[model samples]
Target: MSEPSRPGPARRSRLLRTARRWTVRLVVALAGALLGVLLLGRVEAPIGPFDATVALRPAGGGAHLDIPPLGALEVDAYDGPLQLDLQLRRVDEVRAEALATNPVLLDGVVDQVSEDLRDAVVKVSWMTALAAVAGAAGASLLLLRRPREVFLTLGVATGLVAGTAGLAAATWRPQALSQPTYTGLLVNAPSLIGSAQEIVARFDAYRASLEDLVANVGTLYSALSALPAPGGTDDTVALLHVSDLHLNPAGFDLVRQVATQFDVDGILDTGDITDWGSEPENSLITAVGTLDVPYVFIRGNHDSAVTGGLVAAQPNATVLDDSEVTVAGISVVGTPDPRFTPDKDATGDPGSLEQSGEELAEIADGLPEPPAIAMVHDPRQAPPLDGAVPLVLAGHTHEREVTELEEGTRLMAQGSTGGAGLRGLQGEFPEPLTCTVLYLDRATGALTAYDDVTLGGLGETEVTIERTVVGPPAPDNGETGTDGGTEPTGTPASPTG
Candidate 1:
């Protein structure tokens, strides 16, 4: 008779159903509470016009001072504060509240805002956890009371929350968090009010200086175009020499402007067109193709075989590495720098420089006619070609220099035309941006006269143009010519501005 009291299948089934119901309800409640906390999280809103002038120095020892959005500001002397306007458009509730409390000290305001944001985030996180637990308990109780309607309730709640979120996302337009306005003042230790006035005054001066610089550039261009030909020779050809462009798009505009102004017959580029020779960087070659004049290119240490191929493909460009080409009646030969650094850490083949020099020297020795100009990237490699070519032109050293080698050969090292090839932006003192206008004798195909134009040194925005004459190559006897010809020296003159 006692065996009749044992648990039956129906009883077991009922107990299992109860457990399942409690589990489902508990899960729904937990999920709903979590969703509630997330929905109640802090929202960012715009607070009315908030603007402050903050003085900042260079983060480290360098000439460039970065002002967000305005980019790095190149300063001649880092002895003063570069005042800039910091405008806050919209911020989270925590940040807005913090800013409202202490609007005086910029540093204090920033610190408070940061602390408040962290606290808000932490508070939301804890609330989310608590809500999740509370939601699980509440959902379980609701399911126990009305099991039939639980699914309908959950479905409606989910649809409403999802639709609301979707609509908000679709309609919401994000605005920039902050905007920086440059105020061209270099105050060493400026008071708050004094800084504002100085900023305004300096800003006005900066605008005027910019206008002057533009006017000077225009005047310089006009003068270059109108210059009289030496010895009244109409056969004289003007060639613009530039190098180490390093993907600076500004180089294109400057080159085009100079080429157009001077009626340049051709342009010689000595490589480093890109920092890294990647496929995407090949787009820069398009700018070269747009030039109306012939563009002669040779790869530098930074260039790759792929880059050379791309330059060769351009309609207006001729890749002259290890090759000869006649441009504007001047016989030109070029050899690309053999040292190839694929990445920053990868040093080029150590012996590539010597090998390349030898290869180029051999090519020069075998030339049918004396090349008017020999182009290479490294100056060290140029010495080998002495006496093989009349004039040797190279870059890599971002400084303008002209030196006569032991042989009759003359080496003209053009300064970087791309403003030291983007290294100028690294906050260090950058080499002055330079380009040369070479005037060649038509019959002789020899360099006659040249103009060296220098602009925008490191932090300086002034332009300087110097004119110099090139004497005929030294007498073939490996001795300085007894013809009494003097090597031309650069005569510096300030720009019109």
Candidate 2:
């Protein structure tokens, strides 16, 4: 009856206009609610109160943790369970020894995302449900007067929730697979200092090896089976072997004395010419200037890579950079430090040490013939000489004053040739570099090694002319010492003693 009364044009127009207004308002409200629900669905986990502690143990044992409210946690080897045993506790604690394992990246996608968004998501989900119910109730109330508007609002709300959920699911992925965005050196100051101490200890070990080598050389000189006549032309082959000079002036003097004493034919300046390669024109090359013969050099890790390039340009100098050179009919090979390479590859799997070793072997192969002498910075590179090379010259591991590895290829190491002998006295650092001369005979290809300079005064630190003859009845050539090996038999030319 009321509708029939609305037959009046003004009343009918007002009614129709009011209905349209109501429909528009309903549609707007529904659309806004749907959009909000979608946004809420995309939110992530919120930050929660948390604390953690990791205590390492040793001996395959695990770690013990006291997280307080989180309770004490015990982790075993490979992050195993934590036990009460003292040994077990030590196993985890021992992680302090490994530099790489100590600091580890945190895992899990939840950890990678922000906590605020997570909390927001939870809040939005619950709120969205409430919103949906409200929307439905409002739509129902309008059904009698604006059925089309009510239906439209309901459809919009549902679509929003569905769309948001779908988007969130599509974007979700395991964060573990993501590459690391941050990195830092894990070494602690104290640990670094301790490592330095270890290096010093290693240098001590290196020094020890040099002493042993010196003793052996002395023994060889003392027992002369038969002095072989000097072979080759007036070009008497002088063996100039200088080790661990550290580019110090005093070291050069020693080299000069030895050179004059042995009358060296050629010079074999072993590893560690300078304290580091960065400082150019150090005592090593400066002292080398005094020598008239060809000078060959191999790099020590302590030497700077930059300086290594410079050595090649020096007069009468042949810098061996993973390459070979032919001097006096003898072949020589050189290698840089191997530590610069990594143990793994792009796949995150362990790779072969062959990458480094084989390259070195190849360099050694470049030598003119068999029974070649190879030079390197570290002793670890001493092994696997590719059989083609016999003598391996090394200096990185200073024998704790003097030591040796039995049953392996002959390894010549000159302990620190520096003044203080504190040279390379860090962890596993070779002893102060000692100086030695290597004599290679072209006729029979026989080789003899000698040390002209001791770790003493400045006069014995420079490079000198050295000459050695290999034949039956080796000539004294003013050099002292017999075949049995005592001191050099040649006369002291420059005062290396």
Candidate 3:
């Protein structure tokens, strides 16, 4: 027997080389096909000459439209001139003209444009798929003979494509393509184009309504401007008093509107600017600071130590916790709340509230001139400062109240300016939003009159302003009179523009 001839070493090596070559070719072919599929998936074509026109009248801000199947189309005619721009993928050429000059011709142009774009998109998408397949097949063939070179080429191409896509994704904004200079209507289907035109007409009518609204607002502003300004005396300084905003952004707008309408010289905030005293809640300070007048703030239980720091950073804000500052000719002092948590009954350490009141009283005693006004978060804490200050302003009760202390000091406890500070939004029964505008005798720094403005609770829209006079007789010599005070006389007032 020939003892089963064993394969020679050369023959075995040849067989191994062939097996390895075939294995590499298979992997390369699979990889090439995968890369081609990924590239193809990213390809997109524009379905245009779809016509889109945007008409914006000067009075209205603008309107936007995106016709289906096309990339995106935007027009901005806010400045009274038609500006249009169209964006589409794989479009060889696009012809657009301002249809504003000829309304009758718009429908025809849009029909032509839409049809052309649909055809182009079909052709482009098909062509792109065929190219991707052809490229993948060619790469697979090249890998079989030139594996090393083919790998290098594939890697470089993949890197380039990926890098380009990433850059485009990061920097591209669809709005950037909608420039103000481009003007035209480009679409293909007459019916679709007609719909687009109808949309523009409706938008134009809407713009006309907006124009009327703008004119009415302008007229209202003029009427307000012509009205007698506040007391018409530099001695009469108005202060907008608010507190317990609790992160309600609408409160800021309402405050600004009131301040502008009242022409207040400054703002006085008691406390509870935020609910939890967090870092993110600090953004409320920017809105508060934009009032463009002196802003005196006091810390509340909801205000953390960081809240104080943020308030201090505002240009027009002053943090007054156991501290006194003179603003708008009146000495203002503040006492922070004792509690750190949300519990109304929790006053932190047992003596903290008393201690805070004592500290504030001490500060007031040391002042050469006692503060014209003292502010605290809780009215319960106001009695300690009763005779020490003429007026004690406070929040946290979520209900507005005015009391005349035996010593002639008045404690004005304001309602929650943010409608119970978002807690009102959770329940069916929500607290109404309220704020006060105080008119002070610039000379005596005494409260002459005040407006208690109450708006609908939480989501309600009713607003009522009750103007109240502080006297049958004003306080004597800037101090409360010895004679027993009369109840404040109030009359309803309309909200001025």
Residue 96, candidate 1: alpha-carbon lDDT: 43
Q: Considering TM-score, which of the candidate structures 1 and 3 is the better prediction for this target? A: 1
Give the clashing pairs for model 1.
29-135, 29-136, 30-136
C-alpha RMSD in Å of predicted model 3 compared with the true structure: 16.4
Output the lDDT of residue 189, model 2: 18
- Each candidate: what lDDT? 0.63, 0.47, 0.63
Candidate 3 local Cα displacement, residue 413, angstroms: 0.8
Query: In lDDT terms, how accurate is model 2?
Result: 0.47
Question: C-alpha displacement of 365 in model 2, angstroms?
Answer: 3.7
- Tens digit of lDDT per residue, candidate 1, span 1-497? 45568678999999999787655654565466445544432223222222222222112211333333323333232122111112233234564456445435332543554564445434543443444444444564455557554654455445434543354345433231112223332221132213334444443443344344445677676655455655455889888999887775545556787788777899999878876676656756777887889999999988889999988888988998788999978998899988776343455554676677678878877888777888888787776788788788888878889887777677889878877544554433545567888888888887778888776643455776767766554566777753323466444445644
Comparing candidate 1 with candidate 2, which one achieves the higher lDDT? 1
lDDT of 3 by residue, 365-432 (tens): 89998788998988877877878988889998788999987777889999988775545544345576
Clashes of each: 3, 123, 18
Quote the lDDT for 187 in model 3.
Answer: 29
